[model samples]
Target: MASRLTQARNRVVDRMVNAPRDTDERALRRAVAGKTVLVTGASFGLGEATARTLARHGAIVLAVARTAERLDELVAAIEAEGGKAYAYPADLSDFDSIGPLADKMIAEHGGIDIVINNAGKSMRRSLDLQYDRFHDFTRMVNVNYLGPVRLLLAVLPHMRERGSGQIVNVSTIGVRIPPGPRWGVYQSTKGAFDIWLRSIAPEIKVDGIDVSTIYMTLIYTRMSAPTPSMRKLPGMSAKEASGLVTRAIIGREREITPWWVTPAQATDAVARGAVTWGMGILHRNSSDTASARGEAVR
Candidate 1:
């Protein structure tokens, strides 16, 4: 009975959070065919799916990730399907390496037509557990903020000079909703990049560059797998998440937020105090994960 009740709640939450999006394959082909597209985090989950879909539509995919073997496998799989892809294995968290990676891509491809900033890191640890781990904050900031920014800075000039490009940021819906406890590092880092991109969108618009931010909701992947509670929640599949990303590629919408988010944002604005109090109560009742508390999983 308890399990059934949990499942029922998950269904309700999924319905409220997930929105249906239609993608016209013809449109996607028209937008990306023969174009050089770069996808970060392409070794697994959503990014991997998105890269494959884009390649199927005839995009010349540049798959970027830290795992060389996985990236090679992804490229091989794309090739087997008569798609074009090249593996570029690099760590997005390493700020020093991003410039060289971007430069090499530019040098090799002449200039990229689309950039999918899909790489990210997520953490959910409370402040008490974080006091001894300053690197946690730095790691998230590096992966979620500075790294993407550095890559963009490297490629923006080339895109600007050409006067045509597209940048799709695979951001989280957490940045849109009210702040919850234990997400301070992740949320703040993601929020910083979101704001930075929005601020620069106007300046780059005149250069014929389209900027799209997909504020995505939960999708079960390795990133969320470590959290036992996330496994019980209703979320998108890899294919479903990739569809929204490809839709963003086809339509170039400035922002693709869940339909429910706007109203939730409004409610959050008006009931800020109430929301804070409720979240505080919930946080107090919840204990940190074993990993967050620096303990063994077993």
Candidate 2:
């Protein structure tokens, strides 16, 4: 009954906050008409879903990813649906590769009104594995942290010059709710970027750029496939997450979605070691059930 009331209240709040008539997806999309957007990791998962959705909403979309093949498929999919999309293949980790990609987009479209930093990696190897396989941590940091920061640097100048832009970092809730033991490296790097963005928000806000850090929870995507427990829990779908992200970009909202994550973050912060210890127990228990054989902590 308590959960039911929470849902009812959440629905009412959603309607009030989003403006009931605009809560109709199409009307919400119309808010972004003629806007230009660039999404990283657009080859798959939430990134691809966001690109297609934004394109369908009359926003010009430039999709960037490392896999040329997957990106081509995304472009074709959006075009087939009568939406505008362009795919640019570039290894985001390679700083040299970003320039040309950004150049091409600016050349064709002038300047981007929104940028979604959605590229990331998830790792869950046993803590014992780090003794020799340190590359797992290094590679994850390079791909997930530095790569997005570099992309932001590349496009920021244009945004400053234009005096209007929105940047959304599709970060993970693990940074705050880190289950510990295995999440050190992944969350450490993710947390760094999350803080980095916050540090710059005040200065950038004056330049007409809205920077939002999104701490998302478990989602139904390829990234979540290895951790089998997500299937049983209430998880956000790629399309659903994408829709929330899109609304954030369009509405110029700060810290979008997983609205519940804020209280969870405060709990973790106030409890400190106690929170980590509790989460560690939750991790072990969730990973133990037979049904979660592959879904739990690996």
Candidate 3:
């Protein structure tokens, strides 16, 4: 019975997050063929799948990640499949290094046609436990917000000069949903970028550069592995999530979110007070349970 329920939930989730229709690979190929695209966090998960998919569709994929070895393997695999790819390993969190990396990419590729800001960090530690761990907030903001912004600032000029480009930000649904306990760090950082991108979208559009933000839900990836409680929850696969990114690339939509997200956001806003109170109670219960466990261990 539990297995059946899980399967049903998975089906619902798949429908919610998956693209409204199957992407025509032929169309994707035509859109990206011979274009240079940059994908961050390309070592694994959604980024890896996106890089592979874009490369297969004839894009010159510049795969960037911290893992040089894994990126080399990805590039080699793409090459073996007759796809064009170049692995560029760099730590996104290292703010000082971004400018040089951008220069190198521009020099090599002449300019990027598309940029997928998919690199980010996720945290789920309770606020109570993070009382002394301020680094949690800083780290997340650096990687999730600052890193992407810096990279964009570095590349935006080049895109502007060409008078054509696309920027796809892989955001999270948490930005639109009610603020949840234990996710303050993650949500805030993601929210920062979401707002930043929205504010700049119109301005960039004037320069003929399209901007897209995909408010992705839970996806099965290494970043989501730490939250064991979420393991059984309905989530999209990395490949499915990658397809949505590709859809955004081809369609050039301003925003892509789950079909149910609008209603959920409306409900959350309407019941804000009650939701906050209930979340407070849940937080207290979680804290009490943890204290009890500590006592039992002692």
The per-prediction tally of clashing pairs is 0, 3, 0
| Model 2 Cα shift for residue 154 (angstroms) | 1.1
TM-scores of all predicted structures: 0.93, 0.84, 0.91
Evaluated at residue 220, the lDDT of candidate 3 is 91
Ranking by TM-score: 1, 3, 2
Distance (Å) between predicted and true CA of 86, model 3?
0.8
Which candidate achieves the best TM-score against the true structure? Answer: 1
Give the CA lDDT, 0 to 100, for residue 22 in model 3: 38
Runs of candidate 3 with Cα error greater than 4 angstroms are 1-13, 16-22, 284-298
Per-residue lDDT of candidate 1, residues 1-298 (tens digit): 5698897986677667775554689999999999999999999999998999999999999999999999999999999999999999998877789899999999998999999999888888889887788888888898899999999999999999999999999989889999889989999999999999999999999999999999998898988887788877778888778888888888899988878888879989999999899999999998777777784211
For candidate 2, write residues 1-298 as lDDT tens digits: 5698888975675443321111347665775678888988899899988888888888878888888999999889888888788888888778888877787788899888888888887776556556766677777778788888888888888899989888888888777653466667778888888888888898889999998767776668988776676676656668867766866765666775455556767887788788878867866664333322233321
Q: Between prediction 2 and prediction 3, which has the larger TM-score?
A: 3
Alpha-carbon shift of residue 13 in model 1 (angstroms): 6.7
- Candidate 3 on 182-232: residue-level lDDT in tens? 878989999999999899998999899999889888889988875666687
Count clashing residue pairs in model 3.
0
Query: Among all windows of ten consecutive residues in candidate 3, which has the lowest summed lDDT?
Result: 289-298
